[model samples]
Target chain A: MLAQGLTITISVLIASAFFGYLFAFIAGLCRLSKNVILRKFTGFYVEIFRGTSLIVQLFWLYYAVPMLFGIELGSNWWVGVIAIALNYGAYMSEIVRGSILAVAKGQTEAATALNMSRFQRMRLVIFPQAVRMMLPEFGNYLIQMLKATSLVSLIGMHDILYYGDILRSSNLSQAPTVYLLVLVFYFILALPLIFLTRKMEDISKKGVASQ
Target chain B: MIEPIVTFNDVHKSFGDVKVLKGIDLDIKPAEKVAIIGPSGSGKTTIIRMLMTLEQPTSGDIIVDGKNLWKMEKKGSMVDANEKHLRNVRGDIGMVFQHFNLFPHMTILENCMTAPIHVKNEDKSTAKQRSIEMLEKVGLGDKLDNYPSQLSGGQKQRVAMARALVMRPKVMLFDEVTSALDPELVGEVLEVIRDIAKEGEMAMILVTHEMDFALDVADKVLFLDEGVIAEQGTASEVIEHSTNERLQSFLHRFRS
Candidate 1:
């Protein structure tokens, strides 16, 4: 009776982080790549995902992708992970690309003059600087990403919002009361992220100031 | 006299249809100090940029330390040299830009150490010691751990010089090295440049707008006008009192 909305909310947050980061890594590399086709495809993918509604993407992945492929991805937990990741990753790639470019060109030249290859330059100089620049943006994206997880309930993913929906239909609680508790549950799931983002912002601000 | 440490012969460069550098020939003996002074858009910076390999030339060879730098074919032709060859040649030539181009994310010490570690593949302790010696020479030893933004413009440029010098390059190409400094800050940076000039083993080519520093410290001076050498002589003849009308007009502008 007391299952409440806790399990559903935890599952969504965990699912988003694990998958969202993978997409961000792949998409970020794709966006930064020299291959014209890879760059354009990643650019197009980001645009398509960012241009359309998140709910549509989720529905397409869950309902359309499996049917198109003629495979059973419905019961797959990994599918939920991939869906959330690709959706948020499109936005995160942009953040990563901008941050990497924001690092001064001189550092790369210095590295080149020192005989470091492009790959080594990116890993040692450019990427580290980009990470520092992108941390604030990443934290912001993480919070938004966490909130976006609630949309999974529509796909019948057993998310916190779905739990609340079931509670609302049950007689143990009044409809209005059950609906109210779900809102509180979302706030519970989302508030910590907001606070965490704010904390990250403060720390990075100090880092920039000290520099 | 045995062989010029650097040679630029019939060099040509163009940006689109706009020719920035016309046919050019120059030579620098080992340990020679040469300064190039010119009007704005006369391509003083471009010459240094080409030497630094920041921009490739449209045609011609740039031989430095007695090798065809603009090309790599054994039979004498331009090269689409691999990154490895480019890096090797670049390692021998160090450049100080007009705007101090220090990496903002790193400490002043790390800024100097980056090449010694990443490029030279020196061990951490050895590179650290060498970089510290360089930072001390440029007077940034106290601010080793501070990032570039925390330092003044002048300090960052000093760190830039230290970073360049740590590699112990055979040739140092300076592109208006102190132009970005505040009037008051220019002297310290120039003093460091003069100090490098004193060492006298490295071939130094300085492009500068500071007429006095060019005349005072440059062994040879070239007055460039509209992408060609308008006049050339020892610093005293070309800069102090030249017969060329174009040179006189240029000096008058600086003097008066």
Candidate 2:
């Protein structure tokens, strides 16, 4: 059971970061577009995902998208993965947009004076700055998505939470220790991300200082 | 005059209802250093911004080497040139702002090489060598690996100048490049600009607040007032003995 839970956790991490980053990149680009119509189009999608609860989004993906589309979404654990990525991708889009905007205007102007086209400017100049700006928030989201995997267990996915519950039912005496272990397990994953956030902030400060 | 490297013909520009440049007719001779100076809100900076193509004119045109830039292609009233053509036009010129807009993510060397590699299509070795030579000329070869934030304001501005110079533009526009620097740091950036201007083969347009420097270095001085050139002459006439009372009163502030 412990092994099964560990494997699932690893899969969750892979699925979320991979697809979350993919959709997030697209959504981020859409948001930064100059065309007001395109920006509004992306804005609507982002609001629907971000403003709603992630759990509800996950539930919709797991139970509803298939029914609405009339296609079979087989239960191969990919449902949890796709659901997490789409949900988190929307939330990550704002972080990406804000960071891209936060980059200094002069940088874009410099690229302009160099005669780089808009695509070249964003690809070479703006996106690099945006990625750096998004790193801390992305790390935070990764940890949050990890914690969110616990919810998938309630839907019959065999995650760590499921193992904890099983252990609790089989040996009631170990409930306190088992729950403490779960807490410690989450903290172990989350605490490193917090450390990484501090490290990045420190690096940025030092980078400025060195400049 | 080398056939009017740049010309502004009755160029009128405004932001919404607030007009910035009203009928700014001017011609920049190749390799001439002209300084534009005025009280705040006098539209001195707008002239340079218009030349840099940062702002578009609401009416009239800017002709660069005989090319009318403001005239976009029209097929039954559909504008075709758009931002892409403007980028190509901008390549023939360079600008340095009050804030040294260096690429913070890149090293100083990369900042200098970006245009040469991407725009000019120069080889990596040529770009690297030129960037090094430019940086060394600006006394920044030692700081090539440093980011803009790691450098002093003066150092960053010098890097900015180097970045523009590396492209070997036909014209360079400076909008108060030293205005944002410390009083002490101002000299270093100015000294570099003076050296470039003195080379006497580069067309340079300057918008500056330093009256003394303008008088010393500028071949001609333009005094702008209320979106028009109130008075303009050789360095002596405008800076030394302005007959205009408003210019005189404006100059009085410098005395204190």
lDDT (Cα, 0-100) at B137 in candidate 2 = 96
Report clash pairs, candidate 2.
A210-B150, A211-B149, A211-B150, A211-B151
Question: Mind giving the per-residue lDDT tens digits that candidate 1 earns over A1-211?
Answer: 3255467557766877767767777888888898999999989999998888887877788888878999866463556666677878888888877777767776666566555677888887778777777777777787777777777677666777777777767776487877677777767767877888787777655333112
> Candidate 1 - CAPRI tier?
acceptable
Tens-digit lDDT string for candidate 1 (B70-188): 67775575566666666667777888877776766678898888778877889999999999999999988899999888988889889988988999888888888787888899999
lDDT of 2 at A8: 83
Clashing pairs in 1: A114-B119
Candidate 2 structure quality by residue, lDDT tens digits, B162-217: 99999888889998998899999999999999899889888888999888888888
Kindly provide the TM-score of model 2 when superposed on the true structure, using C-alpha atoms.
Answer: 0.95
Q: Is the docking of candidate 2 incorrect, acceptable, medium or high quality?
A: medium
Off by over 4 Å in 2: A35-37, A204-211, B75-80
